[model samples]
Structures are given as structure tokens and as C-alpha cells.
Target: TIAAEGGGGWKEYAGGYSDWANYQASVHQAASDKAKVDVRPAARPVAAAAKAKGDKLSWKEQRELEALPERIAALETEQGQLTTLLEDPAIYQRDAKAAQQAAERLAAIDDELMELLERWETLESRAANQG
Candidate 1:
């Protein structure tokens, strides 16, 4: 259906179409920008839990808990060393076996470190809850 009334109807339709397209584009852009943002709340440090009835950790338990950071740091240092070794171009090119071994060792260390961290957190949480 062609409306030929000085092309006013066609101009109005074109103008409306342009406005609608622009509005849709702006909405999509806004949504994309919002999606790019990290909307999750910032994590807070774990608060010390309230003391339980007649619950006290031993001195040894306290000492081990205190030493967690040091142990984690040591493991991190070892991990860094392994990472450096693995990254060496010479090792990758000249000694594939050694590189593979290093990668395996690194993975094992990572697993062990993750386990240790989990255990440490569990113990710490328990201690906090007991205190």
C-alpha cells in the first residue's frame, strides 16, 4: 500500500522506524554494558564465629593454624619455581621428558596445596566457631 500524500506518511513511518531502531540499539548496548560489570557484592573476610559452650582448641592446634600462611607461602614458592622451569624454552625444546615431569610435579603440588588450604580453612573455621 503506497500512500502518496506529499510523501508525509512515508516520512512519518521512516522517522518512526529510525526512532524504534535507535531505541532498540541503545537498550541492547545498555544491557551489554551491564553484563560486563561485576554485579556480585564484594567478598568480606570471614568473621570469627561466636564461642561454643565448653569448647577450646589446644595450643598445638593454635600453632598449626597460625603456621598455615607460612606453609602456603612455601608451597607457592615451590609452585613459582616449577612454573619458571616449565616456562624455560630450553627445557621444552631440549628436554621434553623433564618438562613433562615438572608439569606433573607442579600439578601434584597444586593438588596438595589446594588440599592443605582446604584443611587449614576447615580447621580455622572450626577454631573460630569453637571460640
Candidate 2:
């Protein structure tokens, strides 16, 4: 069994990562079929927030903060796509290079996501601190 945090909650899959990926794809497909509107939270205005915090962030840092959400979202989308591709057993035989590249990209995405999330949290705290 694989335990994971997903869809704003935690769930345990009965099998391994492939099973979890299949389940997630099915869920996403069903949601898309329903044409459900995605209501994402608004991104904070980094410039204004940084200004309010009185130079807590430099201009470059403010720009980085502003771009974080979109960059994170793009990486997540790519990760999901790579996971789906890797789940197909035929992919290994059909094109080994493609499969290998996908796997490498997925690993890179994982590392990128971790770094971005940590930096985002640190910047958010600095931007929110009154002192």
C-alpha cells in the first residue's frame, strides 16, 4: 500500500505507485468530464506584500515570489504527465529513450518542487512578518 497526500487530503492506495497514478488519472478524467470549474486561490501580489513588509524582499526576490506559483503549477502538470506516461508498460519497449528522459525529468521536477516550496514558504513568512 502507498500512502500519499493528494487532492487536499491523504489517501492510501491499495497497490504501488502505478495503481496510485491510475487512480489519480481516473479521478482527474472524471472531474474533467464533469466540466467542473477549477477554483484556485488567488496568488498574493508579491510586490505589494514586499512593500508592505518594508524591504523584506529585494526586487529580484519579489519577482521570484510572484513567479513561484505558476512555475510550481507547470512543474506539477509536467510531473503528472510523466507519471502517466511511465505507468504505461509499453512505453519502456516502444521508446526506451523517451521513457528514460521522462523518468529523468520527473526526478528533476521532484527536486525543483521541493526547492521552490521551501523558498516560497521562507519568502512568505518574511513578507508577512510585521517586524
**Best-performing candidate as measured by lDDT:** 2
Instruction: Please give the RMSD to the true structure for each candidate, in Å.
Output: 21.0, 12.9
lDDT of 2 by residue, 68-119 (tens): 9999999999999988887676775688678666766776687679878987
Record all residue pairs in model 2 with backbone atoms less than 3 Å apart, i.e. clashing.
none
* Superposed model 1: Cα runs more than 4 Å off: 1-55
Point to the candidate with the largest TM-score: 2
**The 10-residue segment with the lowest total lDDT in model 2:** 34-43
Per-candidate Cα lDDT values, in order, are 0.62, 0.71
How high is each candidate's TM-score? 0.54, 0.57
